[model samples]
Target: LRETRSYTWGLVIPDLTNFGFASIARSLEAHCREAGIQLLIACSEDDPALEQRVVDNLISRQVDGLIVASSGHSDDIYARIHDRLPVVQLDRHIGESRLPMVISDACKATAELVRDMASECGAEIYYFGGLLDLSPSRHRLAGYELGLHRAGLEADPARVRHRDYQPSSGYQLMAELVAELGAPPRGLFTASFTLLEGV
Candidate 1:
């Protein structure tokens, strides 16, 4: 009897409806094809239980590796699978696992970008951010504050708004900001592309 080799990887992300995630999936798929590996993709829609189910399904399929853009759950679902196969965390991480991870330097970059925008605008700047519960959103908000401080500008509570990372939330928040300020700020920084579209 001969054993067949498995060269398949599993990827679990929040949602492909977001262009960013879709682009990542496309790139991963292309890379896998070039390397003669099969790619299995799943969307968790930012739900913890859903993510777990997806991971379990991937494990049952006997994937060579797993990549997760985590849902910030505290459970050790990924850890349990670690001994069977390699696991890599992407973007966000689970509560306190020491799993290998690939995360962006969003904080420093965001701060620099905001500083440049403020310099160009020469007026008050406003931040339209995502839900505070998420790590990325929290980091970006910290960056926004750091940028204002570095630019010698004070943080204004009225100029900072947090909402779901959705276009409708962005639109509604922008409308409220406009009504409150009577005009758009000279500089507006949105945390996500979908939110930017609404603004």
Candidate 2:
């Protein structure tokens, strides 16, 4: 059998300050300790250049595997690493890399939740989403639209806002919506917990 103690894995994440990512890191650390493996982790702060740098550093360290929560498209970097060692993507993924991924089906789940809200509220539904460029954000927005369609409601472009997945952006978007409509929508969906906190 392969010696567990001889194995080390590199984990690269966008931001550890985000509660969800921090929790995943903590759980992975615990699991690694139990499995007698060394874990090396890096935070990219949601910058693609920093993410690449961290990945390069990990590659130099000769880790056996890599787990990345990509900040943006880095298929080339990941493809290079995949040729050397196994790579698994977590959460967000680079475009069309075909890497093994573990990501939440936020799209379907969010759609269902929005549908339920719309059914109960019997009013227009608004979506407050994250960065439009990010896959998760795009998925959630698509889900929101699908949910509205399923609920027999038209998706109004004016009622949708895509912003950074930050509390400040959420607050600002919500403020703008209220200023324009004079009241909040009866049904509202926020893509992230941080954004929800802002709302």
Candidate 3:
């Protein structure tokens, strides 16, 4: 018998149709190609059960590594095998996930955006964010609140909406907000481009 390297890895993400995720896949594929590793991508569609199934499938295939953008699932399932499997969480994370993570400074960036908007608009700001169950959404909302506090403004729960990341939801939320306020908001912050599309 001889030792062999399969030179493969698996990636699990919420949605392939999302521009952010697609761009990530492109860059990752290029880097993997340079290193002579085959990259296998799986879409979880933000479903915990489907994500687990894909992850298990990848593990069974004996891939050397995994990158996951989990959908509210804990890391306990992978904690036991990570020493051999090398699981890495990406973009999103479970609360205090045991796996190593690679995520951006979403909170800082969102807060900065809020400040700029407030400074320029001098109007009430409303945030259209995704499900708070995900880390990214929670961080962004926290940033929004922090930004308002820094601007000497109180955080208004009525102005902040936490919903799913879908254009239809975005559209409906905006419509209902306008109906409730009797006018369009002066300052608006949408968490994702897809959400912005609906606006």
Candidate 4:
């Protein structure tokens, strides 16, 4: 939008091997290049402390802006950078911070997925993902129930699983659901990309 070319940007991510994160970073790199900007990509290995350190490093390098994709270190990182540069939060949020955000509509996606599962397979819907401590987890669960209700089906509390958005957590919950329900729900919607790996 700034009709400028040849800017510099810092791309901070939790991990590089994560396909989703890498794809996002590459997309940003491509966009920057196409717009005549240069991007420096960095990874923090999902460690908040490392992310904070990376933030300082990037700032010192004098990058024009930052793209933080759901970091464990977002709160502190953004707090340090917000006053001086543009920081776009993707797939996460820090309350009341004046940072711009670009994120998928997770809640809406969850609701629609559940509703579709209910229709396609006549299956009981389960909402699974994220730590209970996270707002997105809570919101996605709410969306699941709301979607079920909209589809004229009430969510069976027994069918819903809450996990820590990890593959092991997802495996455990899937096992638990099978144990309790005596089978899979015919369709499962996972809010966590990691969980999807297990599913």
Candidate 5:
């Protein structure tokens, strides 16, 4: 009564160059290949419009499912796609939608790590983060604050920077901190590997 399955899955990521995303795509492709499924990977380059076009293109090709690390611009497209196909949000998500998500628990881990940094340094700790529009960033920030609280320290509002998840943003934030203090930070926590690479 129905057409044969395409045996193909689409994966859309914000940045294919990112190591984490690349590894995911690589692992998934391997698995899909072993299962006799073709994996179609697309890079959004962190643009919502580009993401839309790729998703549409994948759908046109009749992909069996999709794994998206969205740009956090909106939920309309993913939600619409989910109606007819299985859409799984990976790494990042727009919000809590009906669709399922596979995300890292950056919150608890961040908090613990920050606490360790505070305890070891016994001084003011600075946080460098990425855009709060995504869930991972928000969770990491909360975790940083929680870590400081656990260490009997307070988060210095002035020392926290929430910029985009780019190497340039990381560099800029580091420069700003150094300029303001006229010295490098003693206790520093960089969230997001891209930001870490930047700083």
Candidate 6:
């Protein structure tokens, strides 16, 4: 019998204030500690350039592996790190880069939320924030559509306002939904936690 040990891993996340990513980081840190491996954590503030710098810094620190919470411009960073080391994508996946990923079932959750909104409130739903270029937003939208269909409602592309996931963008999108949909959507789905706060 052989005793298994954890490997030192570097975690690059979007923001520390991001509860979802933080929760994942905290869990991973505990796991690493238990396994006697060091965990290095870095935050990018959703900036690709910053992410790249952090990745370089972490690599230089001689971490055994890496985990990145994907964000805009992350694809480029992943591309740069693709073969240099073994990297896991936490919370987002890169198809071409072949990075292992752990993420929420956004598609399933979206469908469920939309269905609930439709059934409970007969409420028109509008998903705001984040361009489809991002993973979570896209999956959530797909889920929203599924939920709409389940509720015997149709999706109106106009109702969905995709933009940078920010407080200002959410506020603007909310305004648009109010004007275009003839009312604010009874249910609003936001892509990022900050966007959720904005709403």
Between candidates 4 and 6, name the one with more favorable TM-score: 6
- TM-scores for the candidates: 0.91, 0.90, 0.94, 0.80, 0.93, 0.83
Local accuracy of candidate 1 as per-residue lDDT tens digits, 102-151: 88877898889887787887447889998687778878888888888788
Q: Give the per-residue lDDT of model 3 (tens digit) for 1-199.
A: 1545579999998888788988999899999999999999999988889988999899888898998888955778778658787888899878888689999988899888888788876649999998888999989898888887777778788888867887887898899999999999999998887788777
Model-by-model lDDT, in order?
A: 0.84, 0.84, 0.86, 0.74, 0.87, 0.77
Decreasing TM-score order of the candidates: 3, 5, 1, 2, 6, 4
Q: Is candidate 2 or candidate 5 better by TM-score?
A: 5
All-Cα superposition RMSD per candidate: 1.9, 2.4, 1.5, 3.8, 1.7, 3.8
Output the better candidate (1/5) by TM-score: 5
RMSD of 3: 1.5
Steric clash pairs (candidate 2): none
Q: Residue 156: error of model 5 in Å?
A: 1.2
Best by TM-score: 3
Which portions of model 3 show Cα errors greater than 4 Å? none
**Cα lDDT for residue 117, candidate 2:** 87
Q: Candidate 2: list runs displaced more than 4 Å.
A: 1-6
Please provide, for model 2 over 8-123, each residue's C-alpha lDDT reduced to its tens digit, 9 standing for 90 to 100: 89999877767788899999988998987788999987788888899889878878899998877657878777887889999886788798999999789987888888888754
Model 6, 55-103: lDDT tens digits are: 8898888777888876653466666666777777777665455667778
Between which residue pairs do clashes occur in model 3?
none
The TM-score obtained by model 2 is 0.90
